[model samples]
Target: MSNYSIKAISNASNDAIIQLKELNISFGITEKTSETLPNPAELFLGSFAACILKNVERFSGLMQFGYKKAELLVNAVRLENPPRMDELTYELTIYTQDEKLNSTLLKKNIEKFGTIYNTVKQTCKISGNIIVHKNV
Candidate 1:
């Protein structure tokens, strides 16, 4: 088994900075308020999106498929009473010239193996579609 961890420091307000020791990256975090920085919920959704994209790139390399670029747009619905995410949807656009690559299979593999995707899928409804575009 693999272990992962991060450190977060919060002030008096609803904001904090998270440090990823392994990645050597730090990000400012805040609650869902009027702050300009990203909130926790947005960060969660973004992490999920990033995980899917990472899997896409990994599969493309392993499957010998080439893509010019990939883009993901994610939307999340939050319930007020309990203040939790109800559902999440995303649209993945892949620009590629590889016609032999099956988009359906690629999406399935990502959703099946993605760490963040599977984790979030357990608590919220996850729905999305993959759109492949022929790169000129």
Candidate 2:
């Protein structure tokens, strides 16, 4: 197993930022009273969305799929008692000129082989729907 570590620091006004080393990315977090940025929980949801989006694009290329445009939307509901994400839903729309593309196959490739999807699906209720938009 590969192990990783990162660091986060809080600024003077209670604004905090965490840097992800593997990806060389950083995100800011803060509270309404402390700062204007979103909290950590919201960042988690955004991270999940970003991870899936990146994976889907890579998978689409590997599967030799024709696409004109693509978009993804992610929503997550957090539980109040235990402070955990309870339900997560995703909607992915793919636009392409080819009508013979098997959406089911694309979805299977994503759900079955996507490293991030598989990892997150194990702990949370992860569900996604795929839609194909035919080009005119």
Candidate 3:
């Protein structure tokens, strides 16, 4: 089993910071949350986004495909009563001229193999589509 650990510290009046690896991320906490720093919910969604992107890079070599770049847009809705995210949608745009890239297969691989995507989709509704733009 893989293991991971991080540390976070904050005062009641100041923003919290999480020491992850060699990087320090300062984020909002309680009333300290603002537009400047990402809140917990946004961070959660960011993790999901990162997982998807990471898998894309991993699958590129496995599937024998090359791409110029990939862009993803994620949208989420939070339910106030239970105070949780209820829905998430994503649009992935891949810029590539590779004929080996299969959109359907790639989507299935992401949904099945992604760690964070599976975790969030267990309780939250997730719907998305992949669009491929060919280069001329």
RMSD of each: 2.4, 2.9, 1.4
List clash counts for every candidate, in order: 0, 0, 0
Q: What is the lDDT of residue 135 in candidate 3?
A: 70
What do the candidate models score in CA lDDT, each in turn? 0.84, 0.74, 0.92
User: What shift in Å separates residue 64 of candidate 1 from its native position after superposition?
Assistant: 1.5
Order of candidate numbers by TM-score, starting with the best: 3, 1, 2
Cα distance off (Å), candidate 3, residue 82: 0.9
Better of 1 and 2 by TM-score: 1
Q: Which candidate gets the maximum lDDT versus the true structure?
A: 3
User: Weakest 10 consecutive residues, lDDT, candidate 1?
Assistant: 24-33
Sliding window of 10 residues with minimal summed lDDT for model 2:
24-33
Q: Mind giving the per-residue lDDT tens digits that candidate 3 earns over 1-136?
A: 6788999998888899989999999899867368789988888988999999998999998998999999999999999998999999999999999999998999999999999999999999999999999973
Q: Report how far residue 77 has shifted in candidate 3, in Å.
A: 0.9
Model 3 earns a TM-score of 0.94
**Candidate 2, 26-134: lDDT as tens digits:** 3444344435556676677776777767766787677777777778888888898877888889998988877666788887877887666777788789888989888
Give candidate 2's whole-model lDDT.
0.74
RMSD of 1: 2.4
- Which regions of candidate 1 fall more than 4 Å away from where they truly are? 22-35
